[model samples]
Target: MRSFVYARPETIDGAVSEMTAEPGAAYLAGGTTQVDLMKDEVLRPVRLVDITRLPLREVWSDGDALVVGALVSMEELAGHPVVTERLPLLREALLMGATPQLRHMATMGGNLLQRTRCRYFRDPSVPCNKREPGAGCGAIDGFHRTHAVLGTSAHCIATHPSDAAVALLALGAEVRVRGGEGERVVPLTDFYRLPGSTPHVETVLEHGELITHLEIPLLPRGARSGYLKVRDRASYEFALASVAAALVVEDGTIRRAHLALGGLGTVPWRVPRAEELLRDAAPGEESFAAAADAALAGAVARPDNGFKIELGRRAVVRMLSTLAKES
Candidate 1:
């Protein structure tokens, strides 16, 4: 591993100032993903600013919105009564993601900030535009079975790898950030960026910004929600395709819907069209199929990941059906 300077900040302002003072410094939380990447030479920060010591861990209900601190671990969020009861989709997504041990250690902020799982980015030998701009994307003509089908550009096809993020997007949560500015809230849907010219920049977060917490606005009570993941394995694997849906079906008609897809795009893919289709449709196979079709209508697929378009649709359909039954 590369030798790097390390510092732990007790205050958020100190951490932000330290990071802003250094161009190539990263905030370290669990170090579960960042450490491995450093060893592989995928990432080599000049300084590691430890932020786990900062007091950002908390989970509470603020009126109708459920607030979860960035330092809160997946295990803590998943097991929280407020999370499980009010946002079952989030708990379901967390349960389907990483192993129990990792989940216990992984922070929510770290998970949202995790980098893409693209092979080209991880391997120094490969030519990836994301890792080295102007080098060209290796996945373009190589193995891309796990690549993106939406929001992809010539520069990159790498997809985001967080199931929890998808659920967060579907729930219409907002992320609270602190940086050079005092504090600001960014809608979760707007936090992630599409793989445009700069695939390296996965999020809209500024250089020294620290994610403080996330707030999930309340929807209809007892909302029917579910998260479905399709992967190469049943457990301990990255998603091939996944859908997280929160639906309110009442009197045999859809009242409202929130839809977000994973493993198919550069970010947590929100399908406004799918939500529109489910808005007033009856909970049935035709309705679900229509919503799925609307969600993937204009997806541009690569050679190896064309099947993802169908897989994503089916996953959405299955999740909607399951949630509908529960409703």
Candidate 2:
């Protein structure tokens, strides 16, 4: 076992202080992702600041928005009546994630912050820019079928691996965080950073900051929303291509639309072009196909992963078509 100091902080202030005091400390909630990486030695933190004991586990509401605590488990979030009724997209996304046991332990915050599942990043022997910056990316030219097609850099092409995040992004959620500077809310769409030059830096959050909660903003009432995940396996497998789609139709015209893709991009890929095409348009196969095409228009493809472009397009089209039928 690796050597590390452990601190179970009962308060948010104490958690932040412990994280700030140690330059190489990591916050531990569910340990679903952190522990796996630690076992692989991909992350070698000197200290672990456990934040599970904090009061950040409530599922409440603030007028129109739905507030979910950072420490709330995926299963809890998926099964909550509020989530099931108002945000079926999010509930479906959570249920489509890892197995029931992992979902029972995986926190909403940790799910959003989980690291990429790239083979190179998980294997210490391989050179991964995300795992060890400046070491060069092995997946760039090797075993790259699962790498990203959108929002990727020449340095790293690892795909973001969260099904729930796609739904959250599509639903226009905001991330609440506590840091040395105090509390702030960031649009979930703006929280993730593209792997440009620094593949190691995955988010806009600073070292001392902690994700406290997530809030999904109000959406059009009677909206039909859900997630569809296409994976290599039938169950308990990461998505090969997945879509989180929502639509509100009124008087034969598209009202509000929310769309995002997972397992196909460096971040939770929100396609504004697709959403733009969807807006004011009638529900039809042609519109769905066009919207899907627009979403994948600028996708860049590596050798083995080029199939994902067309696959992702089909997934988008299929998801929209299904949503249209329900509306």
Model 1 residue 76 distance off true place after TM-score fit, in angstroms: 0.3
**Tens digits of per-residue lDDT for model 2 on 1-327?**
389999998899999999999899999999988898898788999999989999988999889889999999999999998888889988898988989999999999999999998989999998998888899999987999888999998899999999999999998899999998899999998999999989899999999899999998766678888799988888888888999999998887788789999999999999988899999999888889999999898899988999999999999988888877883
What TM-score does each of the candidates earn? 0.98, 0.98
Q: What does candidate 1's lDDT look like per residue over 1-327, in tens digits?
A: 899999999999999999999999999999889999999998999999999899899888899998888999999999998877778889999999899999999999999999889999999999998888888999999999999898989899898999999999998899999999789999988898877898877889999999999998766787888888999999789999999898888898899999999999888899998899899889989999999998888889877789999998899899999988983
Model 1: CA > 4 A from native: none
Alpha carbon lDDT at 79, candidate 2:
94
Candidate 2 residue pairs that clash: none
Which residue ranges in model 2 land beyond 4 Å of their true spot?
none
RMSD after Cα superposition, model 1: 1.0
Scored against the true structure, residue 251 in model 2 reaches a CA lDDT of: 84
Error of 2 at 216 (Å): 0.7
